[model samples]
Target: MNAPRLIVGLGNPTDQHASDRHNAGFWFIDALLRHYPGQMRPDTKFFGDVGEVRIGTQVVRLIKPMTYMNRSGQAVGALARFYRIDPEDILVAYDELDLMPGSARLKLGGSSTHNGLRDLTAHLGTPRYWRLRLGIGHPRTLNPGQSVINFVLGRPSAADQQLIEQAIDRSVDHLPVLFRDGWEIATQQLHSADPAMQAKKEAKSSNPKEEAGEKARRRAPEDA
Candidate 1:
């Protein structure tokens, strides 16, 4: 039988870093655990909490490396070697500032200047692994360095937290699809318009009478 595919989530393991924007990977893993409570118990061999789920004949292993975010490759490389898993079968989920909040993109290769990814590539000797980039969104001007750092380390605002939480929940629901249908189709389904957008579209397509009624409702009595 073939070994299970591995899904590694990169993040620091500390209360200070728990809710940070950079810890979206951790948040995603937590979301997955909540969704599959029986699967992701702590395992010392993986250097963190590890869980397993079967997808037909394939077994998928979920890993949350406890070596901290910066040196995540240490734990990840060790686990991969121990399990005899190839880099191609590994999927990494991490935060990316390039994308907007509530958005996620999955791709291969190393396009951005991410130290964690660079380190992983160096350790694995290739950039062939799958990456799920969860966007934390870029910062506004005025002290950009501090802003970026703060974003990575600091807790999000209430609204941002809600967005991130919702995204995390959505990610949990879509993860199986990711493993089954591949990234492209899964991404389309994940990032597609929300119910609000669908409602607006439906409203726009209403009969002419409804449109006239809406317009009349917007007008003053005299104007109507």
Candidate 2:
């Protein structure tokens, strides 16, 4: 693959879920749009918000699927098929629970924790694409009783949120390398750095309210 032609950030589209941990991919896209100053409009054919960004002389298509998160493949598959973009020439960004908060990593292949990725893999029909994992930390680290769904769908503490922002900004700063220098080079640079502005992780419980929400989400659908 040459440079990535399409970049998709996974998230739910509702305003209510805008600041949730699961929306980190959307936040990354929002940050990218702000940096590039492009028009991202809703397109029914794509079933999502679509835009173009020039990263190192390449005009890359950006996608933010409005099809919630579970069926995000519908949007991704549509665009990929339309553009005939190979699975290799694509990148996806989404939240990760395995890494501790304030950390981020770039890699290829499947991260099984994300349902959005599951859909993308099924739709794209390959696991050979690049991925950016914005660490969200595990729920068990925050609180033992906390469920995975609640941890991902809930908003992080203000301090933690700031750390996430720093991670996003740091990733954006490495875009030139990410697009122009190939995934391996970009991954090395991104994985090696310690985030300079990453705020401190908070010392607190996941709270009783979140535990309740956790049960609800588990009973409901996947909140990728």
Candidate 3:
């Protein structure tokens, strides 16, 4: 809704977890930093690596939590409190297992399967912040016996990884629209399947929840 917002990318902070599906948040931020080239430095005070980038004069602080995935609240809560940023002024990006790989959805509120989100919601004492859920897909879809923990901690196949990266790449183009024009514009432009149909589609909805629900269309495992 305003400038100088905090954009947190969630992930574990270790080399071993670097390429795991659970680290999709890290990968998303990595792609962003590569595109925008922020001069990120490890900030002990923030308990994470902090950096800034100006998109048409709006300063967006990009943060990669160093507290690991399970304890993201430490870094996120500290940074937001220090900066006096409201919960609505923050946007978090992370992997989602329920959607197909190469897909992405931006919305507000909680997650069903992400521990990082649960930690964040707990620390913030609310689920009002925005979220960019990058689909990494579920490994159990391909194998019934695969454990969700093992699937997320394990590295994705090269093909799946590329798909996830591409999804992030496409989603990155809407960062400016999201920060400047807010949620509706970001969702309409980014989530719509066809550019020509976006305006017509947006005209059909006034509620962000309805819009996100209709557009996001949460997909669960058929067997589950």
Maximum-lDDT candidate:
2
Regions of candidate 3 where Cα sits further than 4 Å from its true position: 193-224
lDDT of 3 by residue, 94-147 (tens): 988886677788787754557899888888888989888888778678446899
For model 1, residues 1-224, the per-residue Cα lDDT tens digits are 12228888888887877878888898887777677644666677667778776654566788888777767777788788898889878888888877656666667676557767877887787898888777677776322566677767777777777876776787778777766776677767776633334566588667777877777888867785
- Per residue, candidate 2 scores C-alpha lDDT tens digits across 43-124 of 9999999999898788999999999999898999999999999988888889988876677787878658589999999998
In candidate 3, list every pair of residues with a backbone clash: none
User: For each candidate, C-alpha RMSD in Å?
Assistant: 9.4, 11.8, 7.9
Candidate 2 scores a C-alpha RMSD against the true structure in Å of: 11.8
**All candidates' TM-scores?**
0.76, 0.84, 0.83
In model 3, how large is the Cα lDDT of residue 164? 88
Highest TM-score scorer:
2
Clashing residue pairs in candidate 2, if any? none
RMSD of 3: 7.9
Lowest lDDT sum, 10 consecutive residues, model 2, at 196-205
